[model samples]
Each structure stands twice: as C-alpha cells, then as structure tokens.
Target: MFCVSENLYLRDVKLSDSSIVAKWKNDPLIRELSIGLDTKITNENQESDIKKSIESKQPYYIISLKDSDRPIGYIRLNWMDNSERFGWLRFGLGEERGKGYSKEALSSFLQKVFSNDTHRIDAEVYAFNKISLNLLKSLGFIHEGTRRNAYYTKGSFFDVYTLGLLKGEFNYIKRDDK
Candidate 1:
C-alpha cells in the first residue's frame, strides 16, 4: 500500500528499513515512550520482526520523504480485533520527530484505512507524553478512557490514555497545492 501526502509518503515497509527501526528502538528516549521500554532490540531482531511483518497480512508502512526513499520512521496497524474492523496504531520517528511529516503521514494512513473495512482506530498514549496527546486530540481522536498506572518504568508508573477515532469522525484535510 502507498499513501502520498505533500512531501512524504507511507509506503510498504521493506527489509532494508529494519536497520533504521533498530536504531530508533535502541534509543533511550524512543524506548521510554514505547510499550517495549525495557526490552533492548538488536538489528537482527528488527530484521526478524520485519520478516514477520512482510509475511503477515497486516498494514505496515515506512514513512519516507518524496525526495529520498530512505525511511525516517514507520506506522502500523496492530492489535486488530476479531471482527477486523478495529485496530490500534503505533508509530515511531527517529531524528525527524519535530517535523510535520508524521502528521501528514498519519492523516494519509487514517484516510486509507477508513476508506476500507476499518471502522475504528485506537491509540494508547502515556500521560506524560504531551506531544502525542495533543497530536491525537488535534486529529479528532476522542479520549475514551484511561488505564491508570498502566505503564511501569524505573520504579514509577504512568497512566495510559486510550484515544479512539471512528471512521465518520475523521476530517480529511487536503494540502493546498498552490
């Protein structure tokens, strides 16, 4: 699958993107925000995971710039329900965190997913992650509920907010190509 936004595109994740994912996974800051906070990942492990993703019929894409095919991050639809209409979203950006690429990429991905069989999309964000919380809210993701102290790390716990967006609630914004 391929989704084009102004300057970035969400394309099929390739085996070559494993190293970039491994680098991000190994970063302390990135790891702290992710579910696998305590788990250390190696390039080999990332490669194996990529292979599994390639083999599975899941929606996974690498966020890449139009000017360059190299991936700066990735987004995936995960934890799909038995009904196949709902799924959770997980994404990570390496050195391109502050850029608007993620916002565009997510918009494109959501549009693509909702245009098909998917009805609802869920995102679990740590309470301390203000950026993600703001992003989700701005994207029209309703704050459904919170799992208090759901994430434990370094002798402390953090709440996790479960944000959800239904297909009807999504507002697809087009970039003014002027």
Candidate 2:
C-alpha cells in the first residue's frame, strides 16, 4: 500500500529496510515508549519479523519523506478480528521525532484504512505517553477505557489507555491531490 501526504508518504515495507528498522527499534527513546520487550533486536530478527508480516498480509508501511523518499518511521496495523476489519495500530518515528511528522503520516494511513472498509482501529498508549494520546485524540479516536497499572516498565507501573476509532467516526477529508 502507498499513501502520499503533503510532506510524507507511506509505502510497503521491504526486506531491505530491516537494518534501519532495527536501528530505530533499538533506540533508547523508542524502547522506553514501546510496549514491547526492551531487549535489543538484531537486523536478522527484524527481517524475520518483516517476512512474517508480509506473509500474513499485515498493513505495514514505512513512512518516508516525500522529497527524498527516505524512510523515517513505520506504521503497522495488526488485525484483531477474523474478518480483518478491526485492527490494533502501532507506529514509531526514528530521528524524525518531535517534528510533526506523525500526525500527517497517521492521518494519511488512517484514511487509507477506513477507505478500505476497515471497521475500527484501536491503539494502546501508556499513561505517560501524553503525546501519543493527544495525537490519537486529534485524529478522532475516542478514549474507550483505561487499564489501571496494566504495564510495568522503567521501574514503574503505568496505566494503559485504550483508544478506538470507528469508520463512521473518523473525520478525514480527502485532499484532491491524494
């Protein structure tokens, strides 16, 4: 899948992206915010994961700068239903963090998902991840519930906020250029 935004584009993940992806996944900041295990992952391991993701037909895309087509981040949707309509969303930026790239990338990707007949998308954010929470909310995802002390990391427990956006609830206006 390919999606073009004003400043960025989302493209299918290739096996060649493993090294860079591994680098980003291993970053200290990324590890701190991620819900996944903090253990470092090898490029080979990331390639294996990418292979599995492709075989499973998951919506995994690299977010790249439109000008240079250089990948700076990734966004993926893991289906939670048998029909493949409901999914859990995950995304992270590499060196592009705090640059207003996420909002544009996510907005374009969410538009693509909804247009493809996706029913709903859910995202889990740790209570301390205020930036992510606000980003999701800005994109029309509602705060469904919260799991108190659901995750333990960084020597502390954190609440997990569950946010969901139904197709009917998504407020996106397709640009003429898209």
Q: Rate the local accuracy (lDDT) of all candidates.
A: 0.83, 0.88
Tens-digit lDDT string for candidate 2 (68-108): 98899999999998788999999999998887788889989
Clashing pairs in 1: none
Clashing pairs for model 2 are none
Clashes per candidate, residues 3 or more apart or on different chains: 0, 0
Candidate 1 local lDDT, residue 153: 89
Instruction: Compute each candidate's TM-score over C-alphas.
Output: 0.91, 0.92
TM-score of 2: 0.92
Q: What would the per-residue lDDT of candidate 1 be over residues 1-178, giving only the tens digit for each residue? A: 4788888888888788788889987888788887557888888999998888788767778988888876788898874776669998998888887877777788888888888889999999999888888877767799999999988988998999999999999867668421
Highest TM-score against the true fold, candidate = 2
lDDT of 1 at 101: 71
